[model samples]
Target: MKRNDCILAAAIFLFAGLLSVMFFLSGNEQGNYVTVTVDKKVYGTYPLDETQDIEILTEFGHNNLHVENGTVCMTEADCPDGYCKRQGEISTEKETIVCLPHKLVVEIQGAKPNGGRTEEQTDGQTGEDYDILVK
Candidate 1:
């Protein structure tokens, strides 16, 4: 309605835009590793610092996971929707790519957990132990 009001509105919009940009670029920076899981079970753990291609095959289907330039992504998947491949890339702790149809999950962990744990230390069980309880 007035020149001063217009300038004030413009400044507020610009400030808001800059804040959003900063927040988007300041994502978590601690995690340097990725973990792959299928049907809630640990399939493999990979380092984000390395470049590699990982092929995962199971009764449900096949998925190709790729690690490069400190990022991890699902490069291919046989699931009907192929959503896993479209999840883009992840490099921060707690980030994940999920293939619901194949029951697959890829997550970023800040560090390897306790150099891994023994079966006994993990209550003498793993996800496999719950298979019979599922159905």
Candidate 2:
């Protein structure tokens, strides 16, 4: 293969990798997101986009859980281990902060699905489900 061909192939590979990362980070599933913090520091994140339940893990214990609507709350935990279940509910967009050991979690609800609605259609709507554009 010519040098030009090699460069073109490399560029394509890089572009594909970058796009995959962006899509993964974007959380295309469609729900709010949960942010896990440990000892007042951000630890990890989970997708809260209403597609499936959520699970959280920490040094102290592990828990299987789910969130519904806009509420970010905890329903169950490994009570036998004496952790998690007691953490309670956290619904809003960024309100419910959970503390499992040093693992502190915050649930951030993303805006409702846009359904391919253009900006023009969103204008003047009383009830709007729009995500804040950052950048």
Best by lDDT: 1
User: Taking the tens digit of each residue's C-alpha lDDT, what string does model 1 give over 4-102?
Assistant: 999999999999999988877654443477777777667787888889998999888999999998899999999999988998998887677878788
What TM-score would you give candidate 2 relative to the actual structure? 0.41
lDDT of the structure predicted as candidate 2: 0.53
TM-score of 1: 0.62
Stretch of 10 with least lDDT, candidate 2: 126-135
Deviation of model 2 at 18, angstroms? 27
TM-score of each: 0.62, 0.41
Whole-model Cα lDDT per candidate?
A: 0.76, 0.53
